[model samples]
Target: MAQPTYALIRFQEVGAAKVQTGLLVGDRVLALGEDINTLIRHWDTTEGQLDALAASVDGLTGLAVSDVEVLAPVEPVQVLQAGANYRKHVIDLAAAHRGPGEDEAEVRAKTAAMMDARAGEGTPYFFIGLPTAIASATDDLVLPAYSNSHDWELELAAVIGKEAFRVSPEEALEHVFGYTMVNDITTREYVFRKDMPEIGTDWYRAKNAPGFLPTGPLLLPAKFFGNPQDVQVTLKLNGKAMQDESTHDMIFGVAKLVSEASQIIPLRPGDLVLTGSPAGNGAHWGRLLKDGDVMEGTITGLGTQLIHCKDEEPTESGQQ
Candidate 1:
């Protein structure tokens, strides 16, 4: 048996606009940039090409991966997210958005209240946004004018290395390539209040803002983290740390989240599952993103993504 190879990426140079690819084999990283795309085109969407390229690095010369700068590995077509997947986030959301009978019923209806509380707030939540929203690992995020409630959620996103559908949670591990950090940027004021059908309506306008998602540094392979559930996760704005928690706090663990996503759609190679964020999201503080703010997030094995904010015009009130 041979040692498994890994894919790594980085920017071409300081202030470069695009990310380039490389293969991590042993201590050396092989640059695959154009070669990767050429092989993909020739393979016609086959995985064997990637496998071979990953294996062939031993013979490649100056094209070593280590020689290249590291950046986020994949530019995913979609980023799926779980809103309010942390317990503390649930509490914060409840307090921030609480209304009339919501508090009074808390005392008399313990069990019902518990179930009802999560109705609009929790459950295995998920949503998808265009890949174009992703920013390079070192890029700056732009805040649109329409967004008054811009917020950040630190999430561990698993990158799919293979195609899978109707897979069991137990078998979900086989399809994973690796994990990366995602700041599941959001327009809190735009998302519908919990389970409302209106949530779907907001996807187009709310989450699709360019550079809305800041992902990567590199995709740390699944082997890096023996047990995903035990990893610590954190989010920071500017220099102050706001979210400090762990994957153990997730309401739906990685396998379950992957299994559920696979059941609904054909999760193709390179797709991403942003495994939700911890409590202390920006919304809870009544402080949303402002121009010039810097945001950064990290998970146990995955590297960090740091984003500086850029001011921009927001969509008009009825533009969606």
Candidate 2:
């Protein structure tokens, strides 16, 4: 049998104590022999075997997707996120932060030039997110009480399949097991530390809130995704389309991110590297997430994620 085009999912049956791995096909999902973690543990040898098994599985025996509660595909050991990788997104942010009386054209020109220089002489910027921040695609997003400018940034995430360290761009893609969608929710206000002017952006507080990184309806195998550089990423907020851009806008593509990341840190199996989001974020729209807002994000071939937004209730300790 040929390799199946599969979407690996983690789901729980009604009243189940633990999650199970499933092979998503059409409207149904078949039970896998083992959990996603087990597969990831042996990915180098098991990927092809799993694909072949999925291809031969009987669809009729599978459970309807609607019958199970879907969870984020994998609980990564590390979540490394790329920042300012989208050209237009960075340019828009730069223009928005320009000094008073600065010419728009000049800002754009300078930003573009800076991007080119970074691409040539500099390296990609990356940050860490705690695994505790991972949330299911269908989960509700709690807008942190501490932030007034909670925002949305939909992006594509690559799932590492093998241990990688100091790998070159030419061989980086081979280390990727699959791809998924990640909505990199941020608190625009917490991004900058007013208390410490000399200190830079505080991604830890801005991005690591519980349920901030809504990920995965499924994880599509890397080989089936073709070139990760050309996929489309779209996000709609409360039925209105907001972000619509191609991965082509990325200053650093998947291979570059993976290779560069390996040089800085060892990427273990099941680690995730989120390519930066494109333009059309809530910051650009001048509208932050509010109670009852619904964000739907999709990346070509990886599937879509619908996240509901709600305000976190304040406790006596004021901790959410």
Candidate 3:
């Protein structure tokens, strides 16, 4: 059975200038306040207050979810993303970029050993993401005309509820307020910096395009999620399933990720920590995204995100 947890969301009435911080209860939304961020910033008190209001919120509601336009749940001050953190995802990439004569069996064996070693001793590869790139999950996204290899990387992000630094893995999860889904869109060709080989991967250019990180409609409270490791991440392209995997395949679990991240910087309330993506990406299947493609992503318990892709609209300069 699912836990009794309230979803945190932002919504606005048709043509209304104000976006209300809302608690999602069934098909309707109950207005909580004007700023979701403010509520998150004081989640210690907000959590208790929400508990007190749960029974009443369930019975009393303002607007039907269909009557309002849902916005991305929160604007985090920081977006820390993990790369190559999924087991099968890493194996798939290794096989795709393998040297001549590298077979799947051989690649998988080598990858298994390597990943095991990484789990025992290595730290996760973390990167920064531009908050400006985040958009509502259901919005139409324009494929940046700069690259032909736009790919999908569906992820589950941990939303921080408290200020934490240098915390232990055992204590890490205590800082997490909830979880939300995000699709980390990548321009594959730009991943490698040709001009500077030493630079290796240029994540900033390859992954931070506008609307690249399509975020939430619901923020599932941590208590409700219980164990995120069992949560499944799945993405479908044009109604055809492409990526479907679970957090069980994650190299470093959410606790390790959040704890390690805190060692580097202070994770504040409303910040997002993306725990990487699962397998079955475009590179693995040799099918990249193009204009007119649509992606629908869903995670266990979390809601779904529908996105439409189109070519970047021509500007006065005819390019972006």
Best by TM-score: 3
- lDDT of every predicted structure (CA atoms): 0.70, 0.90, 0.89
Candidate numbers sorted by lDDT from highest down? 2, 3, 1
The predicted structure with the larger lDDT, 1 or 3, is: 3
| Collision pairs in model 2 | none
Score candidate 3 by lDDT: 0.89
Predicted candidate 2 versus true structure: per-residue lDDT over 1-320, tens digit per residue: 45667788999998997889988877778888887867877877877776776776675758988899999999798999999999999999999889999998999999999998888888999989999999999999988777679999999999999888999999999899889999999988899899996999999989999999999988888888898988999999988989999999999989999999999889998899999989999899899999999998888987889898998898988676
lDDT of 1 by residue, 81-117 (tens): 7665666566666665667667734633453455356
Instruction: State the TM-score for model 2.
Output: 0.95
Clashing residue pairs, backbone N/CA/C < 3 A, model 3: none
* 259-285: candidate 3 lDDT, tens digit per residue: 999999999989999999899888888
| Model 1 accuracy (lDDT, Cα) | 0.70
Sorted by TM-score (best first), the order is: 3, 2, 1
Worst 10 residues of 1 by lDDT: 35-44
Candidate 1 vs candidate 2: the lDDT winner is 2
